[model samples]
Target: MLSKKIKKLLNRQVNAEFYASNIYLQMCAWAEAEGLDGAAEFFRGHSLEEREHMDKIFNYMAECGAPVTIEEIPKPPSEYDNLMEVLKAAFKHEKKVTAMIKQIAKTAFEKEDYTTFNFIEWFIAEQHEEEVLFGKVLGKAEMLGFTGEPGQTLHIMDSYLKRLAAAH
Candidate 1:
């Protein structure tokens, strides 16, 4: 059984995941509109992954007999200055999520909720991976020389992202 505080935290995390999904979806739309197909696809896949993350927590709450409340997600920005900007935003969001997950893990430890702590361990590791992936993508984009102009360099970056998405 999850303690009341842990249950509340889990519910908040569920909403956060959903919000992250929407943010990615918005970024995908922006990429698509700018004809950055690879970036669009990458963001779309990440959006789906965020939904999976939310579902994982929801299912865990169900298994633990904790009722969850689904809250309305705020609208995410639909416009980005460039691909680099989008990647930077995503990397920042991932960092925020990592902090939140770490806080939950700390709370679980403090409360002696070993079961929840074990479950959240997966998220802690996942957040690390998420941060690394976004950071790598952002670094690669910078190395590709994104000048916010529609040109060969940008096209190459988009193609690279498509390949990355395919492997993902």
Candidate 2:
């Protein structure tokens, strides 16, 4: 059986994941509107991935005999100043999520919930990769200066992102 504290935290994670999905979906919408198809596809994919994350925790809670409560997710912003702005927002969100998951991992360790700990280890690694991935995208956006210009470097970056998105 899971402790109330642990179960509560897990339920909160499910809610957080839902919020993340909404955030990514909003980002995807903005990317599409701004003509960043590659970035749009990337975010679109991540939105689904975040929902999967929520489902994973929900299932884990059931497996642990914990009652699950799905909470209401707040709306995320649908606008950004530019591609750079979008990238910054996403990278910041990823870092925040990494911190959140770290805390959950710590609680799992302290509670000796090895099954939970082991399950969250996957999230820990995934967060790291997510941060790194966003960092790389931010770096590219910074390099290109996305100054609302129509240019070769920007096109190259889009193509790169397309290939990157295709891989995932």
Candidate 3:
């Protein structure tokens, strides 16, 4: 059984994941509108991944005998100045998610909720990968100066993103 505090935190995390998925979806739409097909595909795939993450937490909570509270998700912004801006926003959001996961893990440990703590271990590792993945992409975007425009640089970066998405 999950402690009330832990259950509440898990529910919050589930909502956060949902919000992240929507944000990614919005980014995908922006990328598509800008004609960055590769980036659009990548964001679209990531949006689904984020939904999976939310579902995983929801299932875990249910398995632990805690019924999740479904809450309202705020609308995500649809406008982005450019692809670089979109990547930067995504990287920033990932960092925020990583912090939230760490906080949940820390609270679980402090409360001696080993089951919850153990359950969160996978999320810890996932957040690490998420941050690293976003950071790597952001770094490459910075290096390439990807401006969401039609040019050789955009093609190169788009191809790179397509390959990156495929590799995962």
Candidate 4:
């Protein structure tokens, strides 16, 4: 059983995960429109992963005997100046999510909710991977300046996305 406060917080987290999915999908659309097919595919895959994250939390809530409620997700930006800009935004978003997870973990610890704390350990590990992945993308984009052939960048991005897709 979850305390009322923790339950409410978990519900909010569930909604945030949904919002994350929506935002990534929006990014994918923008990337597709801008002719960055590789980036677009990468974001599309990310959107699917985000949905899985949301379901994970939702299922956890149900398992804990807490009612899961979803809220409306806000619209995400439909365009970016370049691939680097998009990757940078992704890194920032992941950092923010990491902070949110930390807050939840802290609260769980304060309340002595060991089960919730243990559950959140997965997120903590996930955030590290998320940050590193985005950081690498950003780094690659930086190394390959805007003046380079767009096709090459697209190929590189596609390769990364393909690797990710093959993982699951």
Superposing all C-alpha atoms, what RMSD in Å does each candidate have to the true structure?
1.0, 1.6, 1.2, 2.2
Q: RMSD of candidate 3 to the true fold?
A: 1.2
How do all models score by TM-score? 0.96, 0.92, 0.95, 0.88
Higher-scoring candidate on TM-score, 1 or 4: 1
The 10-residue segment with the lowest total lDDT in model 3: 141-150
Model 4 weakest 10-residue run by lDDT: 141-150
Backbone atom clashes (below 3 Å) for every candidate: 0, 0, 0, 0
* Candidate achieving the largest lDDT: 1
lDDT of 2 by residue, 1-168 (tens): 777878888898999999999999999899888788987888899999999999999998988888888877899989777666777788899998899899889998999988889999999999999999988887777777665355776676667777788998
lDDT of 2 at 74: 91
lDDT (Cα, 0-100) at 86 in candidate 1: 84
Candidate 3 regions exceeding 4 Å error are: 147-150
CA lDDT of each prediction against the hidden true structure: 0.91, 0.86, 0.89, 0.81
**What is the overall TM-score of model 1 with all chains considered together?**
0.96
Give the CA lDDT, 0 to 100, for residue 64 in model 3.
84
Reference-based lDDT, residue 138, model 2? 74
Off by over 4 Å in 1: none
Error of 3 at 146 (Å): 3.5
